[model samples]
Target: MTTTISYEQAKAYYEQWGVNVDLALKQLNQIPISIHCWQGDDISGFETIKSELSGGIDVTGNYPGKARNGDELRSDLEKALSLIPGKHRVNLHAIYAETNGQFVDRDEILPEHFAKWVDWAKQNGLGLDFNPTLFSHEKANDGLTLSHPDEHIRQFWIDHCIASRKIGEYFGKELGTPCLTNIWIPDGYKDIPSDRLTPRVRLKESLDTIFEYKTDEKYNIDAVESKLFGLGSESYVVGSHEFYLSYAQQNNKLCLLDTGHFHPTETISNKISTMLLFNEKVALHVSRPVRWDSDHVVILDDELKEIALEIVRNNAIERVLIGLDFFDASINRIAAWIIGTRNMIKALLYALLIPHNYLKELQEQGNFTERLALIEEFKTYPFGAIWDHYCEISNVPIREKWLQEVQIYEKDILSKR
Candidate 1:
């Protein structure tokens, strides 16, 4: 049922086929994009950038919660929300305790803080990115050790899932928006090539529990956030196409693809095809890829970028949830967020310029050679323009304004740097 096409054929079709620029522009504007949050003390810079790009933020991983009570968290959420327009949405991460490469029990999580976060999320219109770290130490530490797979950890994961289910139920009863659970299994292989079969079985067991817990939910409940690993030269799990697709098919779960997670060996089009074969149950965490590092950089149009964008355009699946998974180690946290948001918006605009019908034909045929050829043709078209034309058309003015303000801020920060 999979189609194949050549790169050249894809290019010829794109060159010959006319694209509806206006329609593409409108669709691009409507796409929901978010920024990943690691630091959350002050989101002012993110807010400013959101205002400019007209996108939302996805608060993931660890975030600061120095606030004293639910009201304080709520107040912080409101301030963050106010930065973006009503059309944009925000998702918050469930806080977990980690120590020395292991997940501390739920009892270890500060009760008052936990309750505050739950209540704050309910009071505000934010969604939750429920993590499954209680089940494994990968997110907390780094690698997946198969020989010493934590069986004791399974119970903790079950407890966390049940607790999250309760939170979701509470949200449904109180706020009418279903609490969302996102599972990103950081569990994978390290050195010595551990028993892959055992971890795979455990991964299934954990997912089954999660599915059972949320099966009766009336609203959106769970998304399997699939990741490919990159930590120096270390090997990680869920890094291959076969592994990801097989997991999704086996669990009957929607697949969430992180753009930067894939190794250099994988192809984006192949990933998209897998998602499409599974009824378009795919949500994307879109970011740029850097070799040997999941830098989560801003995506822009180059040859490879065009191919990636083409896959999405041709697929045309509406369930896609776009978010940026980025990190800001330098400068004030706010500025990092702003820069990240601006870059994402620019990437979206670039994607909009792709010739959809041409891509669709190539995808339908599943021809890699034709696909590469078309990509080359696309490269040479109009002086080898990829995303630049769309960027010029859509983001130039906003970027100019951002530059004017950011330059001054950059100078001040650089003086400190």
Candidate 2:
């Protein structure tokens, strides 16, 4: 079978279904996805005296050309940002600091460490977000950080987090957009622990101290991320989803939901509405988890679609933030970034094209059969044509053409690395 639809034809078809193609494109253009910087370097950022990646974090393949340092990582990121549509933001971990052989520890980090990144983002018209690097440090070897049993260890992490917040605020002020500072500590016990409450209590106290100094909300926002479990922390994790969700609500902070930090059968779509309802705004770390929380490259899959649908249906685009959090070193790093990011945008656009009001009316009036039919019928719509048009207007390659660019990049650039 061979078929093709012209722009006029596709636009007319979408209009018939009460979907305004123009509106969809405009909405998608306004939404900026925060691409994780660690992907360029296989989660190995530019920190001196690096520690083993503890917690549930590990990158499998030793793909030939991984970014060894800051320069290579930035160069590859430039290639990636060029291909993706919309004005995007870059998410940076604390480990990616561009120190000029200063050799500062995490607890001693300051806004000066990321001065170049802030300048670069300003020149490129990009927003920036930050995370405190709580794993892969000598102190984190025991699979504990802020929630560590020792007070000195916990306070060290607390000071680091406090420094991270100041740095995030600096990025926000210098770039003229709010910088989201997220705290995700890999503190948990690999085996069954007799005392869980004490650790959590200590964690709460440590967080309280970190948040004691606040930056202007207009410039910076604070968030806490929770994980179900990780590599070493298999038996117990201190910061679970329930803990962070509750803490965020009570303390007036944003709750960051990582898609990979959930049970196999649990879909983040189910939690979106609740987060939107309770918090003033919510942040999301969208990634594909195959079987368990094995951070795989994202695709236009079922859970991703449902997640996009929930946001669009609730009209929570402005109230929610979308960020990518996955690293696959098994393939071309830049391609992995583009594929996952474009799919994130693609899923959102798909959700925007859905006629939600009409469908909701159908379900409310006892027309289950009609509603189900409409749902299935929507799957066959001219979504690809609309998507291609978006790519065209955004000046990016459409269909399979983008992959060819990646291949060329590999031959000329990534292959050399």
Candidate 3:
């Protein structure tokens, strides 16, 4: 039976569910949260909230400058790193090359700048998460193709992979943890299919080169396979489940699934199951998906709320790395970061409160149908009241603060109108 309920109906059902909102809050108080840095504004400013929530942060993607060469980037990162709670650690994004863009000359990167990155990371007691710019294409310029057909293009990829490996080796040899080289190839088809399978094959070959380099160096690499649904008919790498899984297995590489990459076309629970099946070879990129756009919004929607909670319930939280891949030119950077992190943590609280027993039962005896029903039941569950109760108990004093912030935001938006 297709059980459909309106938002009000769902909220009402949640209110009636024998769900002790207070107890739920108490339960949520026990879990910790983490935020991705690109979506966050000022890392140092988040110190107060991070301490209150006992959460960590992941400094990744296009945030100010976490590059290997920029002196100002190093200073900014150092300042941000110092602000994190002693108990909660920070993860640094090492590379800065933009995807689907021009090739970055490796020689332009000063080796001294890279060595300085290693020094800062080691001194701060922080961890490293690497995202190398492997794909070389023109930005704002569509109809770009991988350069493998061009000798210069082939050399670019090779040299990029080699430089990335050297960086990883530096981390492994000095820091004791191999840099988690996160891979996301922007290579894809943009027009009529010339050679559908050729790009995929070439992309895999490029990945294999990196994999071989990492293997030889004995570095622990996590190949973050990503997907984009036909940007104007050009097929992108890591576009499908089968493609990702097959490539990972064939290359003996681990997989990183971006939650936002999947749409309504694929069930979130099914994706979770895939991760569980490939638990040994899988890590997750946690973010919210909205229809076709990888909105990178905070995970606040009911469907994703339930799926995220279920994954944590099944003991898969550690295997997942929380990241907010959000980008919007409208909001000031700091405000956007604060709101995004707040929303993510709030969503995480809801996930953590799902009764362990319910999850365990589904795991042992429930079929897909039964499990889905349980999820729906939880989705309709009232969580705002529970969050309020937690605020009271934890003495966070932020319920009304957030409400006021929302009001101001609304006023600002209306003023623009």
Candidate 4:
């Protein structure tokens, strides 16, 4: 059937359930997903003095045509953005600073170092987010940065985070969108620690120092990311979830919940509503975890849909900050971004198309049988048709047609790289 016919048929089915298909499409268009720049280069930022990949973060598969420099990364990102529907933001790390081949350490990075990124963001009409690189450095070789025992090393990381917030502020000021400056440190112990309290104490102190050097909240919003465990830090992660959640509440900062940072059974979908209740705004690093905290490409799985449903049903779409955070070097990097981001948007669209109010009424009225039946029946609904129409209207390729574009780019651009 033609796309228009399928979409028309699908609209009638949704309207029967009191779903406003057009409103859903309009709302989905306005939600911006912050795409991570590290995906383009396997988190290998454009730092002159490169360090080994540490902090339990690992990107496997040396896929050919991975971005080699800042210009190449931006070029690749532009291509990905072209394929993705709706306006989006790009998240950057402190190590992506362009310093003319000068060995500027993390602590020394300044907003001026990222002036080019700001200019590029302006040109692309994209907002920018920031992260302070806390791993893969001499200071964090022990897998302890902000919580390092050495006061000097701790101070260095603190300075870097402070500097990163300023850069985030610069991005917001230049692009007219507040930057989400998040700090994710791979600080933990490889095995059972005789002392966990001391390290967390130091971490808390370091964060206090960093947050003390505040930037305007109107321009830059600070966030603290917690991890469960990493490659080396299997037993203890200094920045535990409880730690950051409480810290965010007390300090009025944002808590960044990485989907992969929690245990396998723990889902971020369940935590969203709880976080929403306490914090004015919560941040998310949406990712898929296979067995462990592996940064796998996101798929439109049950959890992803439930996450979108929670955000939409609770009317917390604007309050929750959503960002993509997965890096897979095995397949085409651009394809990875396209697939992950498209799935995220698709999940949001799916949630928007659902008759959430009716479902809630069913639950509230204890109509469990009907609720289950309706929910299951909607799974077979013409969601794909609505999605295709959305892509058609948004001027992006519908369905697997986008794969051809990726293949063409791979052959024409990526193969040559």
- Best candidate according to TM-score: 4
Question: Whole-model Cα lDDT per candidate?
Answer: 0.47, 0.88, 0.49, 0.92
- Model 2 scores a TM of 0.97
List model 3 lDDT by residue over 1-417, tens digit each. 111233334345544544444444444444333334433332222111121100111222443322223343344333332222121223333234222233335423323435655676687655555554433223212322232455456556555556665665656666666556666555555555666576666656666665665443354465655565534433443335567677777666666776656554665556666666755635555565555544545536665565566566666665555544554335443344445555655776677656556546776884667777776677656566555444444434344454454345435542342
Tell me the tens digit of each residue's lDDT in model 1 across 275-322: 676645566666556564344445454533543464456555355555
Q: Among all windows of ten consecutive residues in candidate 2, which has the lowest summed lDDT?
A: 1-10
Model 2 lDDT, residue 382, Cα = 80
Model 3, which residues run further than 4 Å from truth?
1-37, 40-104, 107-111, 115-125, 135-147, 172-178, 215-219, 230-240, 359-397, 400-417
Candidate 1's C-alpha runs over 4 A off are 1-22, 39-86, 96-148, 165-180, 215-218, 228-233, 236-241, 303-308, 315-317, 358-397, 403-417
**Please, what are the lDDT tens digits per residue for candidate 4 over residues 39-96?**
9999988888788888899999988999988898999999889888899999998889
Off by over 4 Å in 4: none
Predicted candidate 2 versus true structure: per-residue lDDT over 24-107, tens digit per residue: 889999999999998888788788777767667878787777888877887888888888888899999999887888789999
All candidates: CA RMSD (Å): 10.2, 1.8, 10.3, 1.0
The TM-score of candidate 4 is 0.98
Q: List the residue pairs that clash in candidate 2.
A: 55-231, 56-230, 56-231
For candidate 4, list the clashing residue pairs, or say none.
none
Which whole-number lDDT from 0 to 100 does residue 77 have in model 4?
A: 94
lDDT of 3 at 402: 43
For candidate 2, the per-residue lDDT at 272 reads 90
Highest lDDT: give the candidate number: 4
lDDT computed for candidate 2: 0.88
